[model samples]
Target chain A: MFNTRSMSKLLVVASKDQLDGIVRELYRHHVFHIEDFVETEEEGYEGVKIGMPLPQASAVSTELLRIRAIVSAFGVARSDVVPERKESVSALSARIDAELPQIEAEVSDLVDRRNHLESAIRECETKIAELEPFVPVQVDLSLLRGYEQFSVLAGHIPAKVELPVPAEMYFSGDVSGNLLIAIVPNERLNEAEQFLFEAGFQSMPVPGEEGLAKDRIAWYTQEISRLRAEMEEVDEQVNARKEKHQTFLVACDELLTAEAERAEAPLRFATTDTTFVAEGWVPSENVEALTAALRSVTNGTAYIAEQDFDPVNDNVPIEFDNPDFSKPTEMLMDVYSRPQYTELDPTLLIAIVFPIFFGFILGDVGYGLVLLAMSLGLRRIITGGAGEKLLKVLRNASVSSIIFGVLYSEFLGFALPWEPIGINRHLNIGAEAHGHGPDIVLMLVVSAWAGILHITLGRLIHMRNARRMYKPGKHRNKVVFGQAGWILVMWGILFALWSMFELPLMPSFTGLSPIVAGMNIVTLLGAVMLIVGIVAIGQENSLELLELPTVMSHTLSYARLAAVGISSVAIAMVVNYIAIGMMIEPAMQDLSLMGVIFIIAGIIVFLLGHTLNTALGLLGGGLHSIRLHYVEFFTKFYLGRGKKYDPFGMIRKFTED
Target chain B: MAVETMSVEVAEASARGLVAIGAGLAVGMAGLATAIAQYGIGTAAVGATAENKDIFGLVLVLTVIPETIVIFGLVVALLLLF
Candidate 1:
């Protein structure tokens, strides 16, 4: 159950005529992950050309593209309603070909009218801008062009600039003076140009349009309004057409896409003139359902057989099988990477260990209750995908935190009425300055023990893999010895550390007398094992001796588990202290109205403060707990190098058959 | 104020000052170390997340691992005051 299901290759052969129906049935069932069939030329096997898409594949694909374009042009959003009617390929293809032209023509007529109106509006607007310069001057367009001796030096200037020019050189433009039509004598044009440049001007050509300024402006306004109203009418016509065919277009696109996929699927198989053979992998348990489905689909004309399982082929895809409660833990595996076909499926292990670490770090009944309410109570809002996955993992963490919280007798960092089952934190830190609920020796002992146990599990898995893989022309013996040696050395150091620390959880060795001048039997025995294991590993690489000290540091890294949790509890305590200092602690001392107000305000602070701390605790606790498993535990044995099984099938998110 | 009383107040003030300074060094130095470690990992984590949003959860877990060092230092500093 902890291992990947051993896979068997399957060979499916069917008549060329029944191939399409067979493949469609297989897809709708979604059991098989198809593998491209490879041909060999040794002995009975002679490789031949692989199959190609059928003659109808191109037609279906083109139809699909047309339907997609029609839907997009019709403003049919994916979430809009789609008809459930399924159509035969020939009928859909024929209908799409016949109706596409009429639909295209109908839509284009409205589009052409709207596009024409838009262009007319743009031209009118440009003319209006050109006539703007003459608006302030109150000049007739016909009069400005007839200037003889005084040539109008018309040009653009920076819109915001205001420069005083000679009275004769009248500047005529709106406040946005970008269109300037200044009239100056022909001889003075040179001096005027220099003056204009210094005043931030860029020369522009004058328009030959003839009419009074007011009339031209009025004509442009009226023309633009008329064009816009016509455009609205055109838009209404297009929208009505879209409303009529939106559902049909969406449904047709889905149908054609599915048909195209079915038509092209045969390209992955090998085929003779009359027969086709497909190769793929199916879970052994699903073989019966698959075989029955194929037989039913083809009227028992198709044949399916289980091929030999190739033990040496490392290409087998991994599929996790875990109990329902542990299923969410698969998200952890997916986010990191998949385990190899030969590697242990660590989903169940993660399910068991991940929450325990999370709870240990964020051990508080108050926070646990809040987290539980948010996770379970807010489930309806969380709905799906990443949010739901987070809630599921948080559910387990909350439950464990409640359990650990009970042991610690902490309710939001305040002591509950009940006695503590494990650590009475008030007495641990409140009475003694240096003492703490988590910084004590007991927590350290537990962390070290957890680290040692975790590493041992990894090394054992490594040893089992090495032993199973024993083969000729391989240095498999060293692999086994190397793991065993490390295991011994790690255990020895763990026992030695335990003897040196006087922690509450340490197993008492007082029953036995010390051996070899003050050393206990356990520590001495551990030292001897450490020497032997070091020597065994040293046989492989002398430099590995240098890494032995690193193992001790690795063991000490587990102290983070204690460190993180202790800090979290400390934060909770301070929040409670401040809240009480402001509210409840003084409520009993005074029965005044001000005290009542203060108490209410303090309650608000308490809620807000604990909420912030609890959120941080969740982030810190969740992160560090998983970090221990990913960095400290998995690196010991699991080397995840596997390919994901991505079979050919449309997710059909936007449209469905 | 008498000379003896003044000296006693100054001595107590100096003692508190030393405690505050000690606490600051403990937290400040640990925070700096954590920042250095996180900057390297955080850059890679953001780049990886941009390429594939699916790894966001994993990267988040890895990114906060260095924070424990600062939190541990906070605990030590708090204990030192006591």
Candidate 2:
């Protein structure tokens, strides 16, 4: 399509209220108009009026409501969906005001409960700390065992009596064998040790024997258990408080949501800093009322003027004007950007090709079925209407895979015992015993044909878009020469190759067989087409011209079809061989269980690997297909320079959150 | 004994080769991802700067966004080597 751009400017002077009314009207119609009323610099700001067709008013209303619901649900503050009704906003304001006290009360109660629990925990911790120094302790048995040679110290020493009671009693930390430790800092050790063990048990201690510190260690141990129990109780209380807070938060959210949809009986005008001048199309009938309203709000400062409206140009790329009834599936097409809608809606196209490619790459019937089932199941699991939309795409792709798998005549790692039902069994080319398998060639050729078709359709879209934007004459060459030229060159090259390598010597040139000689002659025309189409479509950018070879190479790159098919077969063969080998001896010995297990394991592995490969293959193939469509195909005639439609009354700043 | 030792060394050599190959693949993928992510973020950063020069500090932080991916890769590679 030829690129067409038009620029216009408008200015309006009105009271703040009238300006706001105009802005609200513009937002209701999805008309993007900028309000440049900055108190600071305002040099780049200009007003523009975007037009809408009167016939689409209801559709516009539905779309606006949908957007509003989505923004409300998702918590986005974009009010441009439907102009916020003044009555509703004021009602919401009143509700927020009424609910503020209750919300604050609940929050205060939660905070109080949390604080009480925290203080209780602190008091428990303080009590535990006070008792920590007085708990009992046990002796280290390993250290005691190591010093067991001095076992005579186990029992009480009766001032140098015969060997004391058994060593076990002392090591077991009994009080009978417990000795008083010196109550001394290092400086008074001599005096303190003499006052205790030195004076009471000289024979057993001999000399330089230190008193025991068991009682002190025991006191700390007992305190630890007591503290742990107290902390655990406090923890339980804290958890209960946290749960209560969570419940309060949930209630708060529900309350706010209910408030948004609540009915109200109020009509209050909001004070405004918002000011806008909008240009919009109305049925010449509504223009009178619109003007009257503007006059009333502006106190006679507003004006209405007529401008030519081109519905086709306004919604170019999107077929919103008069949709073709024959295309029932157009409802599935989603526009990422309205202005670039026509040329850029490649997502649905990608959705169609991705699964087909994935299944082909994977090439395992069992795996394909599994993927279909998995996707369908996942779709069922997803909740909400939005989830259902995502599921719809997955469901479609799964169906495509199931179809492809049936066509491929594969089930698990084995070929179907009989031809699939419904498909003409006798005429099935896929199952024919041609060394490379007739289906592989058929599939590869189809892939190439799909590529050709994609490029052609993209060109057609661009041609329509170009003309719609009023650049019909400039892109005429692309429709006639550029598009048809590439198609011919591609087929011509194929025909020439077939004739050179595939014809029978002579009499073949008889009737329809001079097609070879004709092909040779057609090769020159094809070559010329290849050159002209490339040059015309590329728009003469030197850097883009460098991409010519890359695009051309990828056009032929569907050869990966053969590569993927061969890999699938090779992997299957290796796995099958290993399985058979493992089971051979067992089968001979009549160990059917082992043999069966081997076969099952082998199939599972083959299925798993092939399924993964196919999935990845489909993704790569689909993305590559779209890349070709967007860059090579659309570049032929389409120009994507339209600005996206983003209405005002929305924040333009990006926060990291 | 020599043959056994030689076989052991060969096996170790192959294990090391596998590690090297895996590391190379991991690093290469990470680098490519970082480059793509950085290109998008960098473009946005430039656009932000064009809108407001005062946001320069924020712009610098956003521009460094892709560095994290590469740093993760580097850390993984270091762990594997050690």
For every model in order, what is the number of clashing pairs? 0, 15
Looking at the true structure's interface, with contacts defined as alpha carbon pairs within 8 Å between chains A and B, what fraction does model 1 recover?
Answer: 0.23
Alpha-carbon TM-score of each model against the true structure: 0.77, 0.51
What lDDT score is found at residue A23 in candidate 2?
A: 43
Model 1 pairs whose backbones collide: none
lDDT of 2 by residue, A1-657 (tens): 111123222234444445445544433333233323323234544342222223334543443453344333223332212222222345444544575455445445544654665565565455444323212223332333223234223223323322122222222223344332111233443443444354354322211112223443344446555655665665565455444333323332333332221111001111223433344334333345555655665667665454554544553223222222212212222211123433334444445554455445444456566666766788656643435554555555556655655765655444566554322111112222223223433444555565556656665665555444444564555445444544544544544444345332211212333434455444444455667656654652434545544344444444344334434544544444444444443455575777667667766765666665556544543333333343344455544434433332222121100
Estimate how well candidate 1 is docked, as a DockQ score: 0.31
Query: Per-residue lDDT for B17-47 in model 2, tens only?
Result: 8887776776678778889998998999899
How well is each residue in A1-657 modelled by candidate 1, as lDDT tens digits?
A: 677666667788988888878878877766677887676666655545478787799988887876777776677875555445555557755767788788877867776777788899999999888776666656667766677777776666765344354425455445465566667777777777887799888775566677777788898899899889888888888888988877657656766777788788888898877888998887777788888888898989888898876543547766777788888887777777777777677888989998988887787898899899889987887666657877898999899999888888788887778867765444333322333434345666677788788778888887776665456434777877888899989877766756665446766554556787888887787798889899878876788788786576566667677767777777777767667854767884987888888788788888888888888889888877887787777777776655566555654543433
lDDT of 1 by residue, B1-82 (tens): 6664558889999898899799889988989999999999999999999998867756866786677677556655655664
Question: DockQ score of candidate 2?
Answer: 0.03
lDDT (CA) per prediction: 0.75, 0.43
RMSD of 1: 5.9
